[model samples]
Target: MLTGLKTVSKKQKDQFEKEGYLIIKGLFSKQEIAEIDQTFMEMSKKTIKGCFEPIMDQSSEVEDPLKRYPRMMHPHRVNDVAMKYMLHPKVMLILSDLFNENALAAQSMFYFKPPLARGQALHQDNFYLKVEPGTCIAAWTAVDKADLENGTLLVVPKTNNDEIYCPELADSKESFTNQYVKVPKGLKAVPAIMNQGDVLFFNGNLIHGSYRNKTKDRFRKAFICHYAGESTTKISGFYSPLFREDGSKVEPELNPDSGPCGNEFDTVYPH
Candidate 1:
C-alpha cells in the first residue's frame, strides 16, 4: 500500500515518458557534490582490488586516457557515501514514479572521463542488464559541469519504448565501448548539458552515450546508477544483489543468456 511519491510531479513523469529521459536540477547539493568530488579524487590515487584500479603513473604516451584512469565499478560495495546516495530517498522516489512500482537498486558506476579519454558509444542498457518483462532505469548525476566540448552525454529521444537493438562496431578512436546502438532514422542525437549536481534519469532502452572528452583541462566526472522495477523477476548477473532503499539487499533471478547484443566479445560497463 504505497502512495506514489510526491517528490516527483506528474509533469516530470510526463516529460520522461515523452522524451525517455529528464534532467532534474539540484537533485544533489553543492556540498554533496563536493564531497563526492573529494571521495572519487582520493580513490583515483589508489587501487582497490576489484572496485577501482587507476594507474597513477602519469605516462603521456598513453593514447587512451581510460588506460590510465579507469572508471570505478560498484564503489558502493565498500564506500558508505556511495551507498547512501545510491539509495537516496529522492532518487528512489523519482524512480518509483517512473516505474509505477517500487525501485530496486541494481548497479552503480563512477566515470572519471578525463581529457582526451574515449567516451562510451550509444547502446541500450537492456541489451546488457536484460531486465525481464520491463527494463532498467538509470540515474546519472554529474559531479562536474558537463557539456559538448568536455564529453557530455548524448541521447536520442523517444527510444525508451524501442526494443533492444544489436549494436554495431564503434570507432575505437572516439569510443571506449565496443558496441554502438544505431539511432533510428528520424531521431537526432541531443546533448545533455548539465551543471554539477544535476541528475539525468532515462529508460534502459534509451539510446544514449557520451563523446570524447575533447577539452585539455576538464574531466567529465559522473555517478551513474541503474535500477529495476519491483516487477522485475530476472536480470543479468552483472547487476545482481540489488538493494532496497533501507540498505538491504534483494537478489533477483539471473537472466542466464546474453541479450540481443550477443556475447561475441567481452563487454564493459556502459554509463
Candidate 2:
C-alpha cells in the first residue's frame, strides 16, 4: 500500500475490463511527482544521446517549443528515477491484478508537451509493442494537470478488443506523429482529463491520442510506461529487453518489425 492510497477494488478492475481504461486518482504522491518533475526538468537542460535530444536554446521568438523539449523516449534505460517509477510497486501490483499474472515493464516515455507543441496522432499501442499471446498496457502518470486546452489524452471506449488497424497519415500540421486510427462508427473520443499525480491505465489495443497543446503557458507533461504480462514470450524488437518488478532484465523474443500495419507502415518508436 502507498500510504493514503487504497488498493485497486473489484469495481475499478471491472471498469478497466469493461471500458478498456481506468483512471486512478493520486496514484503518485506530491513528493513523487515533484521528484519526476525535477528529474526531467534537469534533464531538459542537456542532451542524452538517443534517449533525449533537446535544443537547449529556445530564446528565438519563432523557435518551436517541441524542438527544445521533445518527448524523452525509453528514458528508464538511462535514468534511475525513471526506472524507479516504471517499476513502481503500486503500479506493478495493479497490473498483476489486471493481467491476472506478474507484469513486466516493457517501455517508459516522458512527454514534455510544451505550449503549442503538436500532439501524437490516434493509434493503438499494440501496433508498436506487438506483445505475443497478450497485449501491453500503459500506466500514464500525469506530472502536471492535463486538460483539453493543454492537450490531454483522448481515448475511445469499447475498443480494447478491436484488432489493430492500419493507420492513415495524419495531418502533419496538427499531429506530430504520422499514424492515425479512425474511431469506430458510433464511438467517440473522450478526454482522459487528469490532475498531477493521477495515473490513467489503458489497454494496448485501445484507440487513443492527443491534440495540439493550445494553451500558451501550460505544459501537459506525463510519465508514461508500458507493461506486458509475465506470460508474454515475444515483443517488438525495439522493446526487446524488458524488466521485472525486482529490477531484473528479461529478454523476450523479438517480434518482427513488420506487423499488422505492414512493412510499408512498420511502426517505429518515436525518438
Candidate 3:
C-alpha cells in the first residue's frame, strides 16, 4: 500500500465490481508518458526480420496503416525505458489490490493507431489470453490522449460475470447474439476519454475494443500490460514466442480443442 498516495477508493472499487472496469485518471506523469512514447517510437523504427520479427511490422493487406504493425511483445528486452513504465508503482499497487496478491507480468502490447485505422473487433481479452477466468487484468496506459475522435476504448458494462462465451473471429460482423455478451440493451457504449498519463484497469473478461482512428494528423498509441495471479497456468497448445535465457523458444502444451475452432493458436507474449 502506498501511503499518502491517492489509491482507488472504496466507492471506485464498488463501481469496478459492478461495471467490470475502472479508469484511473492521471496515473502517469507527462515525463513518464514522454519517456514511454519515445521508446515506442524508437522500437517502431527498427526493421524486424526473423521468426519473431513480424510482431513489430504493421504492413498488412488492410487499408489502414495502423493495422500494419501487429502487437509488439517482450519489449522489456528492447527498451529499458518501457520496462520502467511497465513496473510503475501506481500500476503495481492497483494490480496488487485487484488480484489480492503480487501480480506477475504476462504480456505487453503497443497498439498504435495511425490515421484512418480500423478498430479492433469487440472481444474479451481472455479470448486471446487463454487464462482462467477472473485471474487476469490488463493495464492499458495511453502514451497519447485517447478520445472518441482518435478511436478510444469502448467497453460493455457488467459483462465480466457472464459465462465465457465462445469468442468470434475478428472478421465476424454480426451484432451481439446469445453466443455473444452484447452491450447492454439500453446503455450506450462509453468511450474512455483519457489523458496521456491515464491508465485503464480492466478485467480480462470485460467485453471491450477500440474504434478506428479517423483523424488524419493525430495518432492514438496505447501500451498495455497484462498481469496474472501467481498461480495462473498457461493454456495448452498455445506456444508463447517469448525467449528464454538461452534465446530458445518455450512451447507450452496446447489443448487440442483450444483456439478459434480451426485457426492456429497465436501466442501474444515474449515477442
Candidate 4:
C-alpha cells in the first residue's frame, strides 16, 4: 500500500490509486472560481494568436461552435490569471503527494464546450505527451456546471495501466477530435459531473472522453492542466519549457523525434 495523503483524505488517495482518478470537491473557493470565470469569459471575446485563435466574426454562422470559440491552449503563457491558477497551491500539494515528488506543470488548456458543440474523443494523454518511464497527470477544473447532458468528461475506471492503443478515426458528427481509443470490453464510461470549482485529477493512461453537448442553454467550460513528475527525464517537445510550482520554468530533455500522438503524422488534434 502507498503512504497516505498529506493534505487529502486517505479515501481520496486510495480512490485515485485504485481507480486512477480522484475528484476533489470545491478545490477553489467561490471567489477564486469567479475570477477564473471572469478572466476566461473576457478572453473568449478576443484571440491570442498562437495561444488562442477564435473566429472573430461573432455573426458568421458555422456548424461547429468550436470554430467560433475554440479551446485555448497554453493560456498561462499569455495570461497571468491562467498562470496563477495553473500553479494553485492546493493543486500542487495534492500533485506532490500523488507523484511522491515535486510536480512540474507542462501545459494548460481552457475548453469552452459551448452548447451544441462536439466533445473530445476518448484518448490517452501519454499518446501525445510521450513521457518517458513515468507518465503525465491532469488536473481538470470545471469552470461551469458539467453534467452528462452537457457532455462532461467520461472516464473508464481501472484502465490506467493499459498500454496506449492506436486510435481510430472518431465520428466527426459527435467528436471534435479525429482520434479515438476504443473502450475495452467489460469496462464502462462513468460521467464525471462537476460543479464550478471542483477539480478532477487523473492518470495519463485513463481511457476517457465525452459525448456531444445536447444542452441548448448550458455550456461546459473547463480549465485543464497537465503535469509530469519530478522524476521524468523526457517528454514531447510540444510541452517543452515546463514550469515549477513557484512560477519558474524548467526544460526537460525532449523525447526523440516522432509522430505527434503516437500516430504516423506530426499533426496534433487542435481540440
Task: Give the runs in model 1 whose Cα sits over 4 Å from its true position.
Answer: 1-6, 257-271
Give the lDDT of residue 124 in candidate 3: 72
Pairs that collide, model 1: none
> Which candidate do you rate higher for TM-score, 2 or 3?
2
Candidate 4's residue-wise lDDT over 1-271, tens digit each?
Answer: 1243236678888888899899988888789988998999899887788777777675642566777877888899899999988888888889988888899998898988988888888889888898877888999999998999899999999998898888898877778777899999999989999999899999999999999889888889999999999888899888878899888888888886523332212235332
Scored by lDDT, the top model is 2
Give a tens-digit lDDT track for model 1, residues 1-271.
2354336678988989999999999888899999988988887778986678656667742756776677788788889888988998878988988999999998888999998887888889888888987898999999999999999999999999998887899877778777888889999899999999999999999999988999988999999999999889998886778898888888878887633222213444332
- How displaced is residue 164 in candidate 3, in Å? 1.7
TM-score of each: 0.92, 0.93, 0.77, 0.92
Q: Identify the runs in model 3 with alpha carbons over 4 angstroms from their true place.
A: 1-5, 49-62, 67-69, 169-188, 234-271
In each prediction, how many residue pairs overlap at the backbone (N, C-alpha, C within less than 3 A)? 0, 0, 9, 0
- Model 2 lDDT tens row, 1-271: 3555356799998999989999999888899999999999998889998788777675732466777887888899999999999999889988988898999999898999998888888899999889998799999999999999999999999999899898898877787677799999999999999999999999999999999999998889999999999999999877858999999999988878723211212235431
Q: Write candidate 3's Cα lDDT for 131-186 as tens digits.
A: 64244588999889999988898888887675556754454222111123346466
Which one wins on TM-score? 2
lDDT of 2 at 10: 94
Better of 1 and 3 by TM-score: 1
Candidate 4 or 2, higher lDDT: 2
Measured on C-alpha atoms, candidate 4 has an lDDT of 0.84
| Residue pairs in candidate 3 whose N, alpha carbon or C atoms collide under 3 angstroms | 58-68, 58-69, 59-68, 236-253, 236-254, 236-255, 237-253, 237-254, 242-270
* Residue pairs that clash (backbone atoms under 3 angstroms), model 4: none
Better of 3 and 4 by lDDT: 4
Runs in model 2 lying further than 4 Å from the true structure? 1-5, 57-63, 258-271
